[model samples]
Target: MPAFKQTQRVHDDAFDPSDSASAHLYISFGAHRIRMGVLDAQRNKFVALEDYEVERPSTVENAISFLQTQSVSNPLLQERKWQQVRIGVKNQQFTLIPEALFDLNAREEYLRLNAVVEPEHEMVHHHEHPRLELINVFTLPAALHEWSVPQFKNSPVEFVHQTSALMEGMLHMAERSARPHLFIYVDKNYVTLVVLQGLKLEFCNSFFFTSSEDFIYYVLFVLQEKKMNPDQDAVTVWGELLLDSELHEILRTYIRHVQFGKKPTGVGFSYRFDALFNHRNFDLYSLHFCD
Candidate 1:
């Protein structure tokens, strides 16, 4: 077992969990961290937020244990039975396919042919586009699904790939923008890039990197391959980055319009969350948009 570092914030100290109103629970799990948010559906405000980081032996058991402990300690989680629960898995071995081309019967074979490892224990999941009638086909580990499924058995639960949620979130955010936009989400050991051109998805992929150099290399490579003008195209970044971080500095050196992303405009958050960066925990916040 490993030690887990946890941080949490309560939006309203006067909030009464015994209230009749129901709330939604959103949780996102990564390689080393877990983030959760409790949203009051009627009030349209977040009541509580939490983050847990496992310093060593970052396994599924440790993550689940951390969640279990939080459920016991956090009053907001314990007092109220949530109306809906959604889990976002941040695994990288996923592929996206259009709705028309998706064949439900060949899901496992499709993933297997794409070189997804441990295909036997992975289940296919999909995220439907809001207006295009398109769907994203991806895989989630059975271990995570099995472990989390039982926890939310009493309520309606849906499992989504983090990338799918991010894509949906970005689509909603970028719908009003006319120019081409590149959205980058950085995590512990991987970076996900999503490109949108006039509300249409142009590209979406994830790359693993060991250092800042490798990170920048992939970004630049994608830009060149996509024929996107680094000097003209706009780039919005999110997740695990500070103003002075090495990754931010490197991106600035090559890209002209690099800026941090903002929280989704559709959701309401309490003032207590003002201290945190608007771009952080994008996947967790975006989970609200997941169906």
Candidate 2:
């Protein structure tokens, strides 16, 4: 299958060539898709958004190829003199550790203890959450890491785990509410579940599923294991799901209080995006919160 790219040039006119210095570049890569957003730094609002569906080999080479094409074809990327660049990776084998006991040198062992398979080319990265007193440790393919370095060599680029960005985004959302919330970020065949008990993370894990039954089973299983009542607790879902979709239908059947998650209220988006659903591209948009 050939890769299909969809771009929404909402604020193309907003990109002022003279003010290119006040631009920030954000890119996110997952198993099934690649998404990039360009923001006007001064205005703090997104000016452009691009999404690419992975149909061919979902390899680093294919992803970089798509990115290179975008860099050339997308006027924003080619013309803008971005001041900052941020990349988010949605790879598996990410786990959280208590910040107090985090050891940089022992990341491999920690992952091993958690049953993460060691890859030949791997790099360990951690995101520290001071408020939660937790550190998220994850592995990224060396190929992807090496490929990204030279692409943004002109600027200091920050690499963040997609889950970490999701956590940060969810924490921001949790701040407004006092109740416990279950956040499910759905991808192609996997879902990242994060349980929040009043702004404090209680449980975070990723589960892979092949069928709708498997998906609902894992969600319910996590709820049961966490001692959360489906009837009483709230579940907010985001990403790659439609209201008429089977996944949504199954979830509604079991969970009494399930709703689509909203876009991060902390950031601003162009008015052109008003027609788009707030729940779509939750993780990709959440990359804005990564620091």
Candidate 3:
């Protein structure tokens, strides 16, 4: 491949440019209904290519088959033949996807619910949507829902939380490279802890990444492997947490845009969350979080 060609792809060229995403099928195992759409950028809506239900599948294979073999006539099959598929589950979410069954990683994506909390979460938690720069988040209304999350009756919150984060991660990932990526995080308890770019999130990632250091190391590795800079023209992040002097004094160095859990930046947007990570003692720039 040529170098300039790669650069051209990263920075889209158009009159009105924004990230584009599509779903051959948007099945929420949690919610049986699914939305198949071409992912329109101007509509600011799913434009649902197809609307229906899959009743949720119990295993990864069954779910993929449901999506792949799902009647070719279904309006949801936008690509006709998807080179990949992404599955997002939430709360009591369940079922795995391509990554779970494959030895090769880049071919699929498995986005669990709420995996989008950190960057998208904080960014939206900071700047309102339909307005934020570069990165963004959007609800696929009339698209997908957790009618019945695929999960064991008494699974664990950790698993569920990581799954949610993974889902968010998948949305962000798909929105980024138009492909899947691996996910690992801690929403409450279950921590896949190892996030791999390109391959979509999935059930049972065989790798384990503990500690922020372990996580950052791999990210840096990806940067080097993909040849990106930590600073300019690559991914940037800001984070938040509940205000606690002791915790602040201990981990503040790690947090990006933290404040107390009282006032949040966007009270008018569709999102909901207390900005409990700010402090009266914060410097001027950080004070913006309180508004």
RMSD of each: 2.2, 2.2, 18.7
lDDT of 1 by residue, 26-132 (tens): 88876578877878889887767878787664876567666677667866456445688888888776777677787778666666666566656677776677554
Cα lDDT of all candidates, in order? 0.78, 0.79, 0.28
Q: Write the per-residue lDDT of candidate 3 for residues 91-160, one digit (tens) a residue.
A: 3222233322432231112223323323332211111211111111222212222211221112111111
Candidate 2, 83-165: lDDT as tens digits: 88777888777788998899888877777767565476677877777777888888876767776677666666777888888
Quote the lDDT for 121 in model 2.
69
Task: Report the Cα lDDT for candidate 2.
Answer: 0.79
Clash count, one per candidate: 0, 0, 38
Candidate 3 lDDT for residue 178? 39
Minimal lDDT window, size 10, model 1: 12-21
Q: Could you estimate the TM-score for every candidate?
A: 0.91, 0.91, 0.25
lDDT at residue 201 of model 3 (Cα atoms): 31
By TM-score, the better pick of 1 and 3 is 1
Model 3 TM:
0.25
